[model samples]
Target chain A: AQSVTQLDSHVSVSEGTPVLLRCNYSSSYSPSLFWYVQHPNKGLQLLLKYTSAATLVKGINGFEAEFKKSETSFHLTKPSAHMSDAAEYFCVVSDRAGGSQGNLIFGKGTKLSVKP
Target chain B: EPEVTQTPSHQVTQMGQEVILRCVPISNHLYFYWYRQILGQKVEFLVSFYNNEISEKSEIFDDQFSVERPDGSNFTLKIRSTKLEDSAMYFCASSLWGTSQETQYFGPGTRLLVL
Candidate 1:
């Protein structure tokens, strides 16, 4: 079984300050991890993914995450927080059991707030 | 870039009524999926379709729910009877391949409210 756990239910950061959102996972096999952002009344937008490739993955809007296998963690980070970065972030894990039928498992999600 | 699209952005229905949510995946994509998010809850996967058949489905996709790719370009999820618990935002997603390495693009989603 595969599951994702976002450490924070909500996070607030001041504009121009650094931001961090923590996520942890449990999987039996090698997993595919992803971070997706959703704005109010909008669809989910992919931020980045780690598929056994580079541990440090870069995403759109200057956001990035590091995959640490030992820690069982994939934490998203950004050097500077912007107003547009306010949204809900979900950490997801894909099941790798069946070769071609991996369904995504999503976390409860972390709501981010940017304070100017 | 190509993206997945869904129809009926919002729908309100009475209990026991049937409802169908539609989706049009990106051209050339072979895998399609349906997911939903209830108020104050995590998003949950419902089903996945490929080659006009169901590839995988979750426990939430019970007898009341059925999926079909009636035409070449459209995929639909039918709820035989609407229940208050069924009210949620349903999302449609598609990926070029079913591999774990592939990225699944999602649509804006349909907000279904059951009365």
Candidate 2:
């Protein structure tokens, strides 16, 4: 079974410091990975996606994630943290074995807290 | 920029009552999906619709749940009989194609509270 696991349940970072949120996935075949962020009471916003084209994928809001197949990881990182970067982040894996869209397996989200 | 839109930002209803969550996906998109997230839990897939029919659905989407693309533009999810466990945020999403590789844009979810 394909699954996603967010290593951190909560991460606190001081403003202007670096940020890192770890995620790992298990898939039987090639995986399409994604990172999504959700602000309080808001819909999910696509942060970045790795669809086999690139190992390093950059997303909006100065966030980026690297797909490490050997490690089975897609961890999100940012050089500097902003107060606005505080939100719940989810790591998702899509089943691509079939041509049709499959249900997204989501990680237990990690909440980021930025302290000024 | 076109995005998926859902209605009734929050809804409160009694248990056993019927509730319909409405969504209008990106006009040109052909595939639609419904996902739900319980409070403080991961998002779970409910069902997927394409070509005016259900293409796939998860076990959580039991007989109590049904999806319809009644017209060309609107997609709806109806719960026949709501239960207390049904309280959660329901999200509607769409993609240009029904491929796992395609990005599916999500809408502001409808928070359903079954009391």
Model 2, range B39-91, lDDT digits (tens) per residue? 98989999998898999999999999999998888999999999999999999
Model 1, residue pairs in steric clash: none
Q: Relative to the unseen true structure, what is the C-alpha lDDT of residue A37 in candidate 2, on a scale of 0 to 100?
A: 94
Per-model TM-score on C-alpha atoms: 0.97, 0.97
Which residue pairs in candidate 2 collide?
none
lDDT of 1 by residue, A22-50 (tens): 99999997789999999997888899998
Q: Give lDDT tens digits, candidate 2, residues A41-107.
A: 7778899988888899999999999999999999999999999999999999996654657668899
Q: Which portions of model 1 show Cα errors greater than 4 Å?
A: A97-99
Candidate 2, what DockQ?
A: 0.69
Candidate 1: count of backbone clashes, pairs at least 3 residues apart or interchain: 0
Best by lDDT: 1
The whole-model lDDT of each prediction reads 0.93, 0.92
Model 1 RMSD in angstroms: 1.1
TM-score of the candidate numbered 2?
A: 0.97
